[model samples]
Target: MALGGGTFTTMNKILPGTYINFVSAPRASAALSDRGIAAMPAEFDWGPEGAVFAVESGEFEKRSLELFGYPYTHEKLKGLRDLFRNIRKGYFYRLNTGGEPAKNDFATALHPGTRGNSLRIVIEAAEASTEETPVYDVSTWMDDTRIDLQTVKTAAQLHDNAFVRFQAEATLAATAGANLTGGTDGAAGDAAYQTFLDQIEPYTFHALGCLSDKPAVKALFTAFTKRMRDESGVKFQTVLHRYGQADYEGVISVENGLTGAADDTSAVWWTTGAQAGCAVNKSLTNRVYDGEFEIDTRYTQAQLEEGIQSGGFLLHRVGDETRVLTDINTFVSATEERSSDFGSNQTIRVLDQIGNDIAALFNTKYNGQVPNDAAGRVSLWNDIVRHHQQLQTLRAIQTFEPENVTVEAGDTKKSVVVTDRVTPVNAMEQLYMVCVVA
Candidate 1:
């Protein structure tokens, strides 16, 4: 029999050369994860179809044309621009894929949408090439701006650019320019939004945005969020418009919408990003709205207070600037398991951070690697305490006690039971100062 050199699970083998298991106990493994990510499922006239793509803030400005099929300043990207103002990274899904891609004799547009119709290809004869082996200069343009330039001897030598894919079998020809045509956007229905929700489930984001104003669509997003947060342990908040009936900590209901030409759009996009980008120790209450939308903020003081009682996340004009009325979610009813403090978004963020961080610490440091022994349980307890100390120092949580956390073997040998408690901190939202007459 061959010598058993691999790691041992039960240590029962008779003939074993070396049965060793490697486990990591790095201190850095328990560090808290960053939280500036958001997810959005929206209809785009142009972009990838049937996929979730990540867009980084650092590259959104430079790669706007390539990624979204529009320039950075285009009106089509106004909502995304507002969203990106706060978030660092976003996972976006283009919910429409029912259109035909534009195509010409030389190449086809990379994606389907009306924007592809603006793509044009220009081919010119190079100066230093023989008639038998002619060289050509190809320029890819979106209207007046040339996006890609290539020099090729034949169609076979051309490769796909950002805007279009080359036709390797077509003969090269020189003309003014060939514009891509016949691009169309397929209609986006409920099924498309469902597809987006199904695909975006695996991603970890702090906030999700529902841009649709339809009640049914909002309800779909609301249900999906509750299932993910309650059943799957995925911690995040979903921002919706005019749907306070969700009444869940995982949902933020935007009561006020904007007017003007962008009536369909609302502050939900900005709030989604803001809620995601907000630090766990901070709050968005009274935060000024610095977005591009002309928000509807004509509510009176009584209306604002009433909206808060109804768990409405609304905005109102304070002086000349619009500010958030309250940083809260649609969590009106309190249960035995949850209290009114859960309505505060800052409190929610801290709780979410602790849950996510401790889970990460356990999964990365102790899961499957550490044996279910007293020593292993103690090691896990220490790491959890250290992580909580960091949170306490950061003011995300207050007065964390290491003795409050307990780790023990679960009902089975493969299971580890951990019980932890955290008191999340909330920012001040009210003032009750009185003046004494002298």
Candidate 2:
């Protein structure tokens, strides 16, 4: 059997769990894994409802209308544009799906949202249509742009497309256009966000963001993150707005607000994307804010310092541009088991990478397939060592030694026990120098 795949609590156990190793503080951190995936529940004018939909970074600009029911530059997609600026791929769940779909006599909108109101269907005789054989050209248009065109002899031949579902039983008629109406966006409530969490549980992402400013909603995300990380061994941090009181490593509380928008909590989206996309070797400290929203970086020097001490992920004005004050998660209360290093998001990234990668390797390569013998153990050891070596080369970890890893048979012949060590590296954030005058 594979390891239970979670942090070790007690040595006494009927079932094997995460391996533990004790070493002196003097010595030195995981696989090399890819990053840049983020997840969040978003409110949209039009999109898939009640399920998570994936959007690639490159697809946002070109296929924006098809995927999201709006052009790339549409005002409704501003938040998505801000998020996709950093993330490679995003798992988005539409929080509002209870609205009625816009419909005319001939067709109905595919999804329920206000954007569907812009849809119009134009039907006319095709060039091939003659007295002997008649066919009509049916076209779906969003504003002035003709998106889909189909030639069919009768309405019965019509089928549902991405944008709309045709009325198969309606008689074919030629008209200027029939605009879909009555479309409306549903209100997102606490239950909608809860539905998002339930649906997104199986997805693998580097970061998750809570766009809601409600204390109850933020608390829900915090609890979900902690459960996923500690119990399920799913490693990812949740970004929150003004939720530093969470005091958990699995959460990054954004201290600053946003400008030019009614919702100040929207800035959390940018940080979520940035944190997810950041390399395992890197940190967001002092990184320039290139997102569309203007962050409120108004804070005195002492306040900024105090913010860091309290584990607030803040942005500050640097020259004419805004930049991150320092990269940190809301884990101010560090204990012996979990050291102060865990407070740094960079450190957590490295550690999470290790836990995730090693668990994946064990589950895929060694679980049930390999015998718990000496040769199999050596092979497992080799793979882990190579994974750590790659991370060390990437500077995500430092001073990694292959000998630090030890793999052995567990109490049962079907199980295995492995204990490893790693030293995670953090980005340089501060420097001090002394000038001597002779």
Candidate 3:
């Protein structure tokens, strides 16, 4: 008889391999889970249509040109370049509600946009020593350079390339070049943004950047942010332009746009990327705005203060350079009893780190394997304490007391309850000095 090896939930899980709870946490509770991912849906002239894609740090330039037909530093990609400058990575989805791809007899463009028109295919006969068999050299070219080349006896032997696919059943013939044509960029509409929201639902990201200034678009992003954080336990922040009344801690409303720019909403790109990219232990308060874009500093001191009070991410003139005033999110409605502690992004980062690390630890190491009893609870508590201790060591948090942590039996035998407190550290943004004179 074969030794039975499969997952089981019953008390008698004989022939043990591994029994697992495939069910993910319903929501991120105070007990477990952490957060630090960001997502954005934006309209672009080129890129994969109707899909979410990931771009890692330092890969922005290469990936942008491959997907969007523009280099990171190109004028067409200023917003994207700004974003990558701050954030280490990003999850991007292009909005192409009505775009169309360029096509030819041989193949079609990978994405539907005007940039696809730049693609060209070149075919030539391969050199052969003997006249017994003939070979063809196929090349996929974009702009001036060949991106892909294949040597095959027939078209049937050709494999699909990253830029385009080969036409099945078409007779192969030598051609100097065949440039793709008829690609068009569609108008970015509200439905396009909505489609982006739907497509990016299953993803985890640290922040969502809104490029649109339309009130409706901003409202859609805000509602999505609130719903994801409160209902789904998928915690993240959203950054937008001039959305001062967002009022929630999860939303960051930038108050100013870059001056001397064709696109007024350009600054939001860098700010959103920076907010998402900021390390768990760091704060953006007074962080230097080193982006290529120039801030529109038309507001006076009084106006700037009022803007902060109303939950606006403002850039201030510090001598000759511009600096972020305070890294506070939109939490102007905070009261004394429920202060704007959540307003500080640093506090959120620490809490999010703790929640994420603990959840991962439990899911990977302890879930279902350890018995759900007092000893098991103690083990879990110890692990949690150690996690907090690491954060404390990193100076991400302070004043962690072991006694403050408590894990106990829940209302049900299978459930557990945990309570803990932490003091998140914030970067020093202000200094008060008193000078004594003799």
lDDT of 1 by residue, 345-386 (tens): 998998899888887777787878998899989988888888
TM-score of each: 0.92, 0.90, 0.85
Cα shift from native, residue 156, model 1 (Å):
1.8
Q: What local lDDT does model 1 show for residue 349?
A: 94
> Which residue pairs does candidate 3 place in steric collision?
33-355, 33-356, 34-355, 34-356, 37-205, 37-206, 38-205, 38-206, 38-207
Clashing pairs in 2: 1-414, 29-422, 29-423, 30-354
lDDT of 3 by residue, 39-150 (tens): 7777777787777888876677666677667756678877777787777668887775578888787778877888889898888888851357778888999888688898
Once superposed on the true structure, which residue ranges of model 2 sit more than 4 Å away at CA? 1-31, 130-134, 260-263
- What does candidate 3 score in Cα RMSD to the true structure? 5.8
By lDDT, the candidates rank as: 1, 2, 3
In order, how many clashes per candidate?
Answer: 0, 4, 9
Evaluate residue 233 in candidate 1 and report its C-alpha lDDT on the 0 to 100 scale: 88
Q: List ranges where model 3 is wrong by over 4 Å.
A: 1-37, 129-136, 152-154, 169-175, 261-263
> Which residue window of length 10 is worst by lDDT in model 1?
257-266
Candidate 3 shows a clash count of: 9
* Candidate 1, residue 1: lDDT: 78
